[model samples]
Target: MKQRLNLNLVISMSCYSSLYKPSLFHTTTNADIKAYLVGKLQTCKDLTSATLTHSKAIISGLSYDTFTTNHLINCYLRLLRIDHAHKLFDQMSQRNVVSWTSLMAGYVSHGQPIVALRLFHQMQASLVLPNEFTFATLINACSILANIDIGRRFHALIEIMGFGCNLVVCSSLIDMYGKCNLVDEARLIFDSMCIRNVVSWTSMITTYAQNAIGHYALQLFREFNHLRLDKPNHFMLCSVISACASLGKLGSGKITHGVVIRRGHDANDVIATTLVDMYAKCGCVHYSTKVFRRIQNPSVIPYTSMIVGAAKYGLGTLSLQLFEEMVDRRIKPNDVTFVGALHACSHSGLVDKGLEILDSMNVKYGVMPDAKHYTCIADMLGRVGRIEEAYQLAKSVQVERDGYALLWGTLLSASRLHGRVDIAVEASKRLIESNQQVAGAYVTLSNTYALAGDWENAHNLRSEMKRTGIQKEPGSSWIEIKESTYLFHAGDISNCNQRSEMLSLLRELEERMKEKGYVGGTTGVVFLDVEEEAKVEIMSLHSEKLALAFGLINTPKGVTIRIMKNLRMCRDCHETFKLISDIVERDFIVRDVNRFHHFNNGLCTCGDFW
Candidate 1:
């Protein structure tokens, strides 16, 4: 009886075990767990909480593989949990190239390029070879840091590792070189490439344009047009158009605009903004306004560009209107936008409006005024003979080194204009103390002394400059005609072919001006001992006048003559251009280093204020 009972018990146990076997064996594998965690990390909206929870769960439940750990690090980075990511990275039992690259990228994305570079060096020390992505990320870091030597080291490594042909790597190299101001090296790399893409072309084009080699930029764009590969994108169009604008090549600019329209990129925000800027800088405010109006929902950049364009051409009222409209549209103005508004106020002699805007910058818009904004306000005040207010305003700002220098420089210029010898001396002192290398301050002070009839002091300052080897920059001007640019320096008689005709045209214009009751102003020349007649003669051969003459003689009748000068327009030149505009029955547009001067009908857009 006992043996029979035991057999039945054993038989019952066996039956129960077999019945529940499939359910008991249904457990998740490591791979399945990793996939589930990855999905949660990727799709989670609240990445901070979800990522933290999932990462902890991952740590507790399973031994994470390299792939799983990399994903977790990436998730932490996305959540901006750099500390947690670094901890996990350090705790990893075995790290691969992906592991190192993941953390390096995290550092870069967080704006810690230096930390990223350190991680790269650490990875190199650990003997883990970086992949293409690693190399690309490190190259970007180098670009941001502007560490050209470090970038070259990596380039050498890439070449030795046979990864130079990788398109992404090559593109990054081009960008790195470009940012380092090594455009020629960038071009060499570009030319040597077996394959090219849109990004590579854009990088080279932008480099040339930004480095003041706009002509080269245009030539590159022409070459890029012949390539049957990718079509020019909005970025490329913006860069090339900016190049045209800088060179004052309106013809080339129009051609680029046609390309933009043909490619259906005219509506792109960057393209539209750049087009507005291009037209404005090239002295075609009408075209600029047209382009700006075409945009459906313009942003701050476009609005600011339009405002600045209006101000550049002396349309201050329009600029103010645009500013008000932009505010009404609920768009927040940035620092640059305010600068444009301030510049408009200054040019229009709107002292109250400019002051209101300056006050509102911090109170209403939360945009703190920087050195440039302060400089504009000071300049405006100084222009209207409010020297005390301008001085106080500049002195009130606790600006950086460069900003302080700029403020003082503006004050110095204003003093020179208004014949405030005491203020000019103080400003000159401050400027020299702050930036001893600036030649403008010394020259301005000398000129101020000469204006005050203190010729001895002026001569002493001139002697000091000469003793110190502080040579002032010679003024130069350029005018573009039919795709060719003619350059002239102060007292330049280099172009013998056009010298006689230019001088003759200038003399005729002078005669016409004299008949219209325009007397030559001797204030512009700084040669204290020279006779008044010689001063007038020397002033007549100023670079801007020569360029204006060249433009008038070469261009068609009734066309506006545009000249670009490397320095501020002198008082005499300003008066001469106004008279010439009326006598020639044409507009004279001069873009000096400071601002634009539009002379028409015996009046200047600056309202005789600039």
Candidate 2:
């Protein structure tokens, strides 16, 4: 009732505003009236003020003026009164490119990309040549949709329409390609630009960082500094830090952290959240916790990052504590927050807790459960040897047809781990039937057969894979030694110049390992039909083991050796490292494709569960 009364008073004042200043209105020209309306619209910070000012404009006969009406539309959008903005736009007698572009941009910002696209088509059909802003806005819409086809269409249009050099358009193009996973094309655009701004540089770097091309991202950051471009802002710093995280480059991450501190961006929410994730990913969760604690009032993202970090480190209890803290503080959890929570349960073997959270996702948290949540739950079940339940849960996931690929792959992986040949075959069949060319699924099944000593089946599977052109992605790992990264593939030491020293050190470690009861498992030797001794030798040369050997010899005794791998660490290497850690009494951090394993004193942070 009070709200209605205040609104009625505003209406009365708006209707009688001219009467209150009759002499001024009589003396003022239409231009003066239009200017006054535009000024009012510019300062309209709230819906009530905007509506009052809008009514005054209508009363003063300036509603028909395009410039003033455009201001009104913009002001209405600023006040989040989209209905009023669209109604005003529709009623406009003269619609310019700005009018269409403004409405389209509003829709895009409001997460309605399809509406923005429709408006763009309508704008084109109405014969209004889109300005740079229009092209940039629609390109952003394309990026949000991650639709490369539409992005390409806009790229061609921008080129033909002579907007290719426009900074805004070029940056949007780079971002669109990045979002579409066309990192190479994004780099092409970034390289060809005759003029580059901070936004473009950030976009290109962000593209590399997002795509796991962290080394390239660091290279770009170095060039960005060499060119003496604008100083790196929080956005660019966040991207560089993310690159460090992806590569698990603690040295680089520390340097970037220094930059964050010097620039006083440590307090910035986005940068702080990114720092949490970066430290966590770089195998430094203590730093992550410190940053998380320093946040004045942490949001869902920061909490989620910390939770995910804990989950990765097998600190499931801590993850749940942070989650409860967030809820107690009245910070609502988003879908990603729930994902991190579920990951905590999955990683820590909290099966009952995971199921409870999954069940409460929609009912208690108001966040709907999707295939992603189901994947975590299924993993939690699978980790505990509930293979059938996991498979059934994976089957029950209802999502986009393509989403089944992850489900199938998960089931296949779990089945392979538990030696469930029947379920592994079933998962592989589903993969084939769904036409999901997941090379990893076939590789897992083939490895499963080999592990079962069914060499004939394994050989046949390999033949089938060759016939289908589904080659498994080769596994590789790299370690950063004294700021230089050295990569190694299975049994391949040709790429490193210090291969002999690395081999010598590896042989010594193996001798010490055997003395410490480390008879290497032959489980990872699936592709070969070699003798057990030969298999142990083959396992010793796996990429991650080679990287570890290199790190152990090169780094100082007290320093933590960090290595990053492109695939999950094999069980033999996992066990070998546990023993090597005990023998050497040094900390070794291995960031694999799955999770980080910190081996210290014959114990892994994963507690041997992972």
lDDT of candidate model 2 versus the reference: 0.71
Tens-place lDDT per residue, model 2, 236-315, is 99999988887878888889999999998988988988888887766567899999999999988899999988776567
**lDDT for each of the candidates?**
0.69, 0.71
Q: Could you tell me which 10 consecutive residues in candidate 1 have the lowest summed lDDT?
A: 596-605
TM-score of each: 0.76, 0.83
Stretches > 4 Å off in candidate 2: 1-28, 490-610
Per-candidate RMSD vs. true structure?
A: 10.9, 6.8
Structure candidate 2, residue pairs in collision? none
lDDT of 1 by residue, 555-609 (tens): 2221212223421222234345455456445543433222211111111111111
Query: Pairing residues by index, what is the TM-score of model 1?
Result: 0.76
* Residue 174 local lDDT, model 1: 88
Q: List candidate 1 stretches off by more than 4 Å.
A: 1-63, 72-94, 106-110, 121-127, 147-166, 191-194, 227-229, 500-610
Please give the range of 10 consecutive residues that has the lowest summed lDDT in model 2: 598-607
Give per-candidate clash totals. Answer: 0, 0
